[model samples]
Structures are given as C-alpha cells and as structure tokens.
Target: MQTIMYGIPNCDTIKKAKKWLDDNNIPFLFHDYRKDGLDSNLISQLYQTLSWDELLNKRSTSYRALTDQQKESLNEKSASLLFIEFPTLIKRPLVIHQGVAIIGFNQKNYQTFFAV
Candidate 1:
C-alpha cells in the first residue's frame, strides 16, 4: 500500500514528517483532513493500529477547547464523532505505512518504520 500521512499542512510536526520523507526520497501522499474531512473507515483503520489513548491529541487546543462534559463523556464512539467534527483533535500525521498507523514522527522511529 502507498504511504499516506494525514494531518493539516500547517502543522509543524507534519512539516517535519513531510521533510523527512522527502529527504529520504520516500514517496508519500499527504491527506489534509482539515480540507478533505475525516471518515469513519479511516478512523477505524487508525484504531486498528492504536487505541483511543494513543490516537487522541489531548494536548491539542482543539481538544482542550472541548466542554468539560464532552471531555468527561469521551469514549471510543463519542470520541470518534468529536474527531470527525474536529480533525485537529486527532494526533498529527497519523501516518499509514504498510497498513500500520504511526501516530507521530520521530527521526529514529521513522528510520525504523520505513526501514530507511
């Protein structure tokens, strides 16, 4: 399968990930969830590789902006809805490589993950 990185274009981490891919000559496709909109099938695929704790960007301003009630009630189903409604709430660059989802970018991890 083709490598696909999902995140907003302006995100610093996304920028770094893209640069690393380009520098290593690793071909990939960037999916701007902010523009393209997230779908349940994609969300499910991500969940297959990682759990809610791993996928949720709790530190994100978009997530912090949620009402206390929303935060308190978060579960896989509810969180999925929130993620769909707010793409920024999900972790940056949920990279799908070889049918696995890598939640974030790290140089060493990328090297190993991509086997570069």
Candidate 2:
C-alpha cells in the first residue's frame, strides 16, 4: 500500500512514527507540512474524512494560545483556516495509507493497518 506521512520534522511523535516505519520496512513519502506548507485541497480532503476535532490538536501550544473566542467558535471552515495558518495546530504524523487517512501514531495501529 502506498503511504504518505505528514508532520513537522522536529515532532517527537513523528520521529517515533518514522522510525517505526523504517524499522518495519514500510516505505512512505514524508511531507513536512511546516516547511512544505499545507495544500488547501488536501486539508479539505482530510477534513472530509476526519472530524474537525480530530484534525485540530487541542493539546498543542498553538491551540492553547488561541483566544477563547477562537477555540469556542470552531467549525470546519474556521478550523481549516486556523490549521492553514498554524500547521502545528494539526496533529502530527497524519498517515495516509492507500488513501486511508490515519491521525496520530500508535505502534499497534500501524501494525494492524500495515499488517506487519
């Protein structure tokens, strides 16, 4: 299955995920969203598959720094805008394997998804 991994290069979770993929021999294209910049269409596509809540990293420093109004008034469009402006606000290591988008990293999930 073709896979693409999206995240900031310095993210610890992303590092772990990349290492796991490497160790398991899973080849994937790594997209550094912070450096590469997020495509609006791709963000829309991910939003369609995953909830705004899922895509939004509420635990992120960026998220925490948001005004209460910004956090409380979140909807798809607004959240997308926020994510486009702050890539770190989106979760790390969003993996798309064979067109299936998986958010976050977990060894067990990777094992099951890749069947490795």
On residues 6-113, what C-alpha lDDT tens digit does candidate 2 reach at each position?
A: 889999999999999999999999988877778788788787668888888988999999999999999988998898889999988899888788888899998998
Model 2 residue 90 CA deviation in Å: 0.7
TM-score for each model: 0.93, 0.93
The prediction achieving the highest lDDT against the true structure is 1
Question: Candidates' lDDT values, in order?
Answer: 0.90, 0.88
Tens digits of lDDT, candidate 1, 79-104: 88888899989898889998887878
Which regions in candidate 1 have their CA more than 4 angstroms from the true location? none
Error of 2 at 10 (Å): 0.1
Which pairs clash in model 2? none
